[model samples]
Target: MKKNYFILLFILIITSQACGVSVKYSFTGTNLDPRVKSVQIDYFPNNAVLVEPSLSQTFTTNFRDLFLTQANLDLVDSGGDLQFEGEITGYKINPMTATAEQTAAQNRLTITVNVRFYNNIVEDDNFERNFSHYYDYDADTQLIGSALDDAFEEIIERISQDIFNASVAKW
Candidate 1:
C-alpha cells in the first residue's frame, strides 16, 4: 500500500509539471513554441535552368503538406507566426557510375532550393539557405514517364523533411 501511494504521487507530480511546461511537444518530434500557432508558405517557383513544368506546383504543394501533416500549426496565407518562402534554383542530371563499356551506368538527378524561414515569435530562428536532395536511376531507363515522376517524389520528400527539421525540429 505504501509503494502504490508513492507511484501515484510521482505520476501526479509529473502530470502537473507537464501541464505547466512552456515547451510544446508533438508526436512528430517537433518542439514548437506555443505562441507560434500558424504558418504561411509562399509559392515556390522553379527557376532551374533545366526546368520541369510541373515541378513548381508539385514541390510547393508537398512542402506545405508536410508541415500540416507533421505539426499542429494552422496554415495561413500571410503574416503568420512562421513564414516560408523560396524558389527552386537548381535541377541537374549527371552521369554517376560508368559501365564496363565506358557508358553511363547510373544517372543522378539533383534538385536544390533556396529556402527562407521566418519566425516572428523568435527572431533568432529565421534563416535563408539552400536545401538539396538527389535520386539515382539506372542509366538504361530514360528519366521520363514513371521514372521521372518517382524521382521527383523522392527528392521532394527528402528536401521538405530537411527544411522541416531545420526550421522547427531544431535538429
Candidate 2:
C-alpha cells in the first residue's frame, strides 16, 4: 500500500509537469502581469498645506524602491509598461488624547497621498486613488528631527504598501 501511494504521487507530479501546470507566487504579494517589464515613477510633489521639506524626495524614492526590490521590472524614464504619478494632498496634525489638565496628551499626524497609476499592458488595470496613514506621538515631542523622521517612515510605509496592493496585488 505504501509503495502504491508513492507511485501514485509520482505519476501525478509527472502528469502535471507534462501538462505544463504551474503556479507562481511572489513574497511581496505582487501579481503583476507578465507583460509588465518596466515601471516609471514620476516625482511625488508635496502640495499639502503643511509640507515637510524632505517628504517629496523621500516618498518618491521609497515608492520606486518597492518596485525595484520586489518586482522584476526596470525603472524607466518614460514609456514604461507600468507608471505612477501623484501628489501629497494633505498633511495635518491634530490632538488625539487630552490630559486631565486640558492639555493634549498625544497628537496624531496624518498624511494623505493622491496616486494615479497607469498600466500600459492592461488599460483596465489603471486607477487613481488616495492613500492616507497616521502616526501618533506624545504631545511633548515636537514634530521635528527624529520624531518627524519616524512619523514619515511609518506613514510612508503604509501608503506605499497600499499603493502596491492597489496596483499589482489581486488580494
Candidate 3:
C-alpha cells in the first residue's frame, strides 16, 4: 500500500508541476503553438558600397546567437519552422559638422540592413523591414578604423535584439 501511495504521489507532483509552469510571452493573445520548433538563418548578403568581408558572416552569426539565447527555439538549416534572410544595403560615412575653422569636424558612419522574416507555420507574421543606425566620429579622435568597427558591432547587436523582440517577444 505504501509503495503504491508513493508512486501515486510522485505522479501527482509531476503533473502539478507541469500544469503550474507556463512559458511567459510564448504567445501573443493566443495560446502557445507548438508547431514551430526549429529556425534557420541564412547568410546576410552585403551589398553596401564599402564592402566589409566579414560583415555578412558577423551579422548572420550574431542574429542566430541572439535568437538562440532569447527564444526557446532550435536552429536548423532547412525545413525549419522559421527562416530569415537579409542584406546589408547601406554603409556610408558623411561629414557631420564643420569645425570652428569651417572644416569638417565630425563624421557620421551609418549602416543599414534589410531583413525578411518568415514563419513557415504562420504566413501572416512574415514580413520584410529595413533597419539602420549611425555612429559619430570626431576628427580629433584617433583609431578611426577601430572605432568604426566597434560601432558596427554595437549596431549589429542592437539590430539583432530588435529582430528577436519583433519575432519572438510578441510585443
Candidate 4:
C-alpha cells in the first residue's frame, strides 16, 4: 500500500510539471508577439457627436487600468516596446420600438472606440482596429441617467477586454 501511494505521488508531480503552463499566448499569424516588455497608452480623445463630460478621461483611465491588471507589461510614458493611441469615435442613443405595443419602449446606447497600436520591438507586428459595444435600458425607468452610466461602464469593460486579447492573448 505504501509503495502504491508513493508511485501515485510521483506520477502526480511529473504530470503537473508536464502541463506546459505559460503566461504568454502563442498565435500562428497574429500581430501579438511576446517580445514586448512595456507599453504606452495615450489618453483616448473623444470625437463623438454626443459628448459625455468625462467620457474621454474615463475611457483612457479604464483602458490603462485594464492593461495594468491583465497584462505582464509595464506602463511607460515613452520609449516603450509597444504604444497605443486613439479616440472615442462614436456614441449614440436611439429609441427601441417594442414589438408588442408597436411603440418605443427602451433606448439602446452604443459606444465605439478606435485604437491604433504599434510594436516597436517587433517591426512586423502592428494593428489598427475599431471595437464597439452597446447596452440598453427601459424607457420607463426613472433612473435613466444612472442606467446610462452603468451602460458606459459595461462598454468600457468590454472594450478593455477586447484590446487586451488583441494585444496579448492573440485573439
Candidate 5:
C-alpha cells in the first residue's frame, strides 16, 4: 500500500507539471498580481527649483533597480502590466538647527518626487502622488563628493522603497 501511495504522489506531481500548473510566490511581502509580469519606469527629470545635476538619473536608476530586485518582473519599454512615471519636483536645503553664536549648526536636504503608478491588472491599485524625504548634515559640511553621494544614496533608497511599498507591496 505504501508503494502504491508513493507511485500516486509521483504521478500527481508529474501531471501538474505537464499541465503547466504554477504558483507565484512572494518572499518580499509583495502583493503583486500574478498577471503583472512586466514593468516600465519612465525617466524622471528634475523639475525642482533647486536642480541637482545628477539627481534625475540617480533617482530613476535606483527606482528601477528596486523593482527588478524585489518584484521579479521583466523590464519592458512600454505597455507593461505595471508602469511608473514621475518627476522630481522639489530639492531644497535649509538650516535646521542653530548654534548659540547664531550660526547654523545642522542642515537638511529634502527631495520630493511626484509619481504616477499604473497597474493594468488592478485598476483600483493605480495612483498618482508625491512622496518626499530628507537627509541632515552638519552646517559646516558642504554637500559635495562623498557627502552628496551619501545624501543621494540615503534619499533615493528611501523614496524608491516608498514607491515599492505603494505600487508593489500595496502598503
Candidate 6:
C-alpha cells in the first residue's frame, strides 16, 4: 500500500509541474507572444547590381512560405502585427581559392538582402539589417544550368531562414 501511495504522489507532482510550465512549445522552436496574430511581407525586389530575373520572385515567395509553414500567425496584406520588407541589395561572384597554376580553383556566389522588420506589439524588437549567404563552386564550371539553380536554391534557403529567425524567432 505504501509503495502504491508513493507512485501516485510522484505522478501527481509531475503533472502539476507540467501544468505550471506556461510556454507553448512547437516544432519550429518559436516562442511567439500570445498577442501576435498576423504577419505581412512585402515583395522583395531584386535591386542587386547583378540581378537574376527570377530571384526576387523566388525569394519573396520563400520568405512568405516560411512564416506560413512554421508559425501559426495569419498572413495579412498590410498593417499586420508583424511585418517584413526588404530588397536584394547585392549579388557578386568572386574567386575564393587559387589552384597550383595560380588561377582560380573555386568561385563563390554571394547574395545579400537588406531587411526591415516591424513588430507593432513590441516596438523595441524591430530592426533593419542586411543578411547575406553564399555558395562556392569549381572555377572551371560556369554558373549556369543546374549548377546555378542549385546555388540559388541553397543561398536563398539560408537567407530566408536567417531573416525569419531575426524578425520572428528572435534567434
- The candidate 1 region of ten consecutive residues with least summed lDDT is 15-24
Q: Check candidate 3 and list the clashing pairs.
A: none
TM-score of model number 6: 0.84
Give RMSD to native, each candidate.
2.5, 3.3, 5.8, 5.6, 4.0, 3.0
Off by over 4 Å in 3: 1-32, 141-145
- Model 3, 116-143: lDDT tens per residue? 9898877777889888877787867652
TM-score of 4: 0.76
How well does model 1 score by local distance difference test? 0.94
Report every candidate's CA lDDT: 0.94, 0.90, 0.78, 0.80, 0.91, 0.89
lDDT of 5 by residue, 60-165 (tens): 9999888889888999989999989989999999999999999999999999999999999888889999999999999999999999999999999999999899
Worst 10 residues of 3 by lDDT: 23-32
Using lDDT as the measure, what is the rank order of every candidate, best first? 1, 5, 2, 6, 4, 3
lDDT of 1 at 20: 62
List TM-scores for all candidates, in order.
0.89, 0.87, 0.76, 0.76, 0.86, 0.84
Across 59-114, the per-residue lDDT of candidate 2 in tens digits comes to: 99999998898877899999999999999999999999999999999999999999
List the candidate 4 regions with Cα displacement exceeding 4 Å.
1-34, 99-101, 142-145
Q: Is candidate 2 or candidate 4 better by lDDT?
A: 2
Kindly give the stretch of ten consecutive residues in candidate 6 with the minimal lDDT sum: 17-26
RMSD of 6: 3.0
- Candidate 1, pairs of clashing residues: none
List of clashing residue pairs for candidate 6: none
Best by lDDT: 1
Q: Give me the displacement of residue 5 in model 4, in angstroms.
A: 22
Model 1 C-alpha lDDT per residue in residues 1-171, reported as the tens digit of each score? 999999999999887775565778889978888999999999999899999999999999999999889999999999999999999999999999999999999999999999999999989999999999999999999988889899999999999999999999988
Candidate 2 lands at a TM-score of: 0.87
Prediction 2 global C-alpha lDDT:
0.90
| Stretches > 4 Å off in candidate 5 | 1-25
